[model samples]
Target chain A: MLLIPCPYCGLRDESEFVYGGPARALPDMDAQTPEAQHSLYRPINPRGPLRELWYHSGGCECWITLTRNTITHEFEDDLS
Target chain B: MGYSALSLMGHAFRGNTQWPTLIAAPDMRTIYDIVIIGGGGHGLATAHYLAKIYGLTNIAVCEAGWIGGGNTARNTTIVRSDYLLNGSFALKHFALKLWEDLTQDLDFNIMYEPRGYIDLAHSDGELEQFELRANAMRLRGADAQILDRSALKARIPLLSLDMDKRFPVSGALFQPAGGVVRHDAVAWGFARKASQAGIHIFQNCPVTGFDISDGVLQGVQTAKGHITCKQALISVAGESSAVAGLAGINLPLNSINVQACVTEPVKPALDAVVNYNVGLSYLSQTAKGEFVLGGATDGYASFARRGSFERIEDVLARAVQMFPFLSRLRLMRHWSGTADITADGNAIVGQTPVSGLMINSGWGYAGFKATPAVGHQLAELLATGILPDLIAPFALDRFALGAEQDDAGIGPYPWLH
Candidate 1:
């Protein structure tokens, strides 16, 4: 089980949080080129370290950023 | 020596020491007509077809490890063609036909069994969806039918079909021709045949880099040596992006871990493969009487060939719920394989932007069943330099043209797909 360290709360079980996928910045909606639309919809599915967003749905219900290695499952809490 | 009753008797009389090697160990040549990366089932099968069908003998299959060590040996070995999409349905149905004659054609035992397959539906809406999928499959000349509750119960007596219970089994999508095969044997059989046809099988040799000049691929630099080739085909399943990155090409693939587990051997109680679609869990009794089980891919993207305990627990919960007797069986082994998933829930095959370079990957969890068809199509593509009509829907340019094949209706999410 993954021990996700929520920013608002402390470390909790993975079931308590919902996976929000890779933490990608939204592209400008007004200038919706195919590339920008793809960036908003599709993922690059990186194999190395990834920045992801996690929602602490079971507890604080706050979103948190996690920098974790997709290959190793090692993570560092980014409270900032 | 050929495997026959006479050969076995002779070997027995001679103390069983005169058996021939399954495949030959040969040094990599400096150059070849074609080079295939990854010696898993797909790569070896591609080599076999290229040599036998296309009559291209100057070929080499490079692998990072021994043959069948990757996902080829790790999958749950379920083969079916009950897909809703046209491309996948056609490809898998073609593969099923090839699998029917694989052992005879390759002169090896692949343990191809056409028992049956059932996908349980829990709700009315899901049952309607299964009916639609069955219609689509039938249109493609694949065998698919909807089985009512009593029919499903009669087919598999052990299935829990209590209507009052939570998550009751309403009906199931039945495919009479779907079944399982010996996964490792498929790879070994292909490797042996391809080797006998004079194709080099290079084990423990990884492609380190690609030698490309002026938008054309010249050769590949490997750990053993740099071998030149006129054309190269990349069929590395989970490492699609990593290998393509060497040639400065980015693919829309993500590597994630999908897990499977097996229970201790028991009496053969289950005959048909049972898949609980709502739970995303599938289980089948192998010929050895062990229950082989598989579940959904990990929600998070990962390259690690291992699974999380949480996912395993989820699978166990669903398994026990569907088959109450499985709760007593202890799990003997559990493992994961890296699946190269695409955003569109379909494989990516055909030429990339670079000339003389082709890729056959992004199969996610569905590559095992499509092995033979992928080989046939890839060989045709390499020999003719024209994308066959069967595989045209899977081109890499589909993503750019907004023509994605999202069969699962999950939309552009690798993990969900």
Candidate 2:
């Protein structure tokens, strides 16, 4: 299991947390625009270092952003 | 000598020392009428169809590694068309039909076995969903039926029937035509045939970048050299995003790692492919008696072609739960492949926003089954410049138009899809 470093609860088991997907900033455009739709649906899925959001559902139940390497799965820092 | 009985006897009498190469190796040309950026199953099949059906011989298939080295050689090899969505149902069944006669058409034994498949349901709600899915498949002229506990047990007695267990087998959706095939043989067979038809198969040549001029794709810059082409098709499975990015075109795809494993060879214990829907594990015994199995994608997205130990442990727990006897069988080997999953579960096919650049990717876990149909439809799109009805529903513009076809019913999640 992944030893996820949650911002509120510190390190916890992966099962206790829910993956919130890639942490992308919401775009400031018309919701109907293709650019806006893509930003909302498409994922960057970067190969190297990634900043993603995770929810400590079983613990603090707060959304936490974590910068980690998707390839290595090593925890970098909690960006909450 | 031809592969006839007399030639075989003559060869045996002559000590059987000489043999001809199956396909010829040709050097890459500076230009081609069409360039297929991958030599995997789908890419090679696309070249085969383009040559045999569309009568287009001026084609080239480029591969960074050997043929079938990517997901084509790494998948679980299960072939079925029992999807709930209409588009998937159509495309997959078309592939199944093509697979039935692929050996005869290519003059190569791909070992396309029609041993059938069973998707187990562990609860009433799951069974109800299977009922709807099976009905939908049947309505689309695909073969699917719901098997009760007794029928399911009769088909595969090894499955655990204890309803009191954590995840019991209540019932299953059986597709009689679903089965497994030899994955690498499909790619090799297509490559051999396409090569014989005068299509160049370039190995160890990777497309490093695209040579686009004025927003139009002019050529591809490969590791060898730049090769101009009238049209280009990117059939690279997991590297769809990276390849498209070379042309400055972004696709609605995410590359994630999915893994599969196989057990040591033993006596045949399972006849049909068994899928535990609740546990997210699917398994089938190979013709050589090794049990090949796979689980769901990793929880997070990554381009690394390696799986985490946690996912493997979770999958093994579920596998042992479903098949108690499997606990004793030692795992022989395991490997992972990078799968390109889209926000919608369905694939993205057709011309991109840029002219002369076409794509046939975002297959995720379903690429092996959809290889034949993907090639046929993609060939049609490349040759005629018109999207075939079978693949029009999977256009790249669907995400922009907000007309996504999420077959898995999981919205906007690439890993889940």
Tell me the DockQ of each model, to 2 decimals. Answer: 0.62, 0.60
Q: What's the CA error at residue B6 for candidate 1, in Å?
A: 1.9
> B109-199, model 1: which lDDT tens digit per residue?
9998988999999999999999999998988788898999989878999988877767888899999999999999999999999999999
Among these predictions, the greatest lDDT belongs to 1
Best candidate (score: DockQ)? 1
Clashing pairs in 1: none
Q: Estimated TM-score per prediction?
A: 0.97, 0.95
Q: Taking chain A by itself, what TM-score does each prediction score?
A: 0.82, 0.82
In terms of docking quality, how is candidate 2 classified?
medium
Candidate 1 regions exceeding 4 Å error are A41-43, A78-80
**What are the interface RMSDs of all the models?**
2.1, 1.8
Candidate 1 residue B133 C-alpha distance from true site, Å: 0.9
Candidate 1 root-mean-square deviation in Å? 1.5
